[model samples]
Target: MKIGYARVSTGLQNLNLQEDSLKKFGCDKIFTDHISGAKSHRPGLESAIEFVRSGDTIVVWRLDRLGRNMEDLIRIVNQLNERGIAFYSLQENISMDKASSTGQLMFHLFAAFAEFERNLILERSAAGREAARARGRFGGRPEKLSNDDLRLIKTLADSGTPIKSIAERWEVSRTTIYRYLGKLN
Candidate 1:
């Protein structure tokens, strides 16, 4: 039996194209979710996984329709293989089953490419951050209080001034004063 899974990013998007493809592919049943691929808790996908058994093949309109990313795609396909099931992507014309060495090789190559791409991205990001630091441009939110404000806060704290009073003067919360004074820690 071929079980089909389809997804759309939002309710505004229709599942017709995916459904039609799955139907044409002779899917015994089709499950769908009107949720983004980034979301983890897709009930329709969960149902499709639960409905399959040994000898069943899971089909999708495209690779992207089945997973949030490359990692997720590999994870799901590996799980299906472990369960004695197969996976097929209609648009990609790629199929994976326990019996196919070519399919397994292709899948492994895909995983390797995904990992290599991630490593390159990490390297580029680190270089970009280093270059930005060299230019005296730091990331993250700017400091809310200036050096003068910090000095005044420290002095007020040393003089045993009430936290609420100092906070009122600075127009910030007492928690902010406590945090700056290292009292919160």
Candidate 2:
């Protein structure tokens, strides 16, 4: 079986291109996610990883889509390798099973580069945060829900309104309502 995995960092990014690429590669199963590669709680990717068995192959639109860090990429690849599952990257024309010694070397090189990129990003973000703190401007946006909103959330929740519906009506996420409810109770 040939399974494909595609992911985007956020909902704003389109998945159609990755999906089309996977389909063109003749993938029998495709899992898609709108979560960042840096995140560990990607349900779609986890599901795809768990779905594969021995003799199965996992196809990806690109190597970076699998993980942003080398350790994560290597861990995932090692897991698949342990299960005798091959990995194919459509863009890189990389098939672990078909890779030559040179190709294998290049794969490790790319993983190192990916790890370096992630480290650079983290370093830049930390620098930016430090600069902002020096200026006393390192806080998040003010909450959209005011005290009135919290009261309304509690009122609706107490009246047996579903948190999902209340969130929709209030133009807020269920998480926000739950946070306020947690504080209230």
Candidate 2: give the clashing pairs: none
Model 2, range 1-185, lDDT digits (tens) per residue? Answer: 99999999988998999999999889999998998887889899999999999888999999889866677777787678777888889998877742357646755775687688789989999999999999999679977888998887888899999999998997888998898899898
| Per-prediction TM-score | 0.76, 0.56
Task: Quickly count the clashes in candidate 1.
Answer: 0
Best by TM-score: 1
lDDT of 2: 0.85
Q: How accurate is candidate 1 locally (lDDT)?
A: 0.90
lDDT per residue (tens digit) for residues 101-122 in model 1? 9878877887897798789889
Candidate 2 error regions (>4 Å):
98-185
Full-model lDDT for every candidate: 0.90, 0.85
Q: Candidate 1 regions off by >4 Å?
A: 9-14, 162-185
Residue pairs whose backbone atoms clash in candidate 1: none
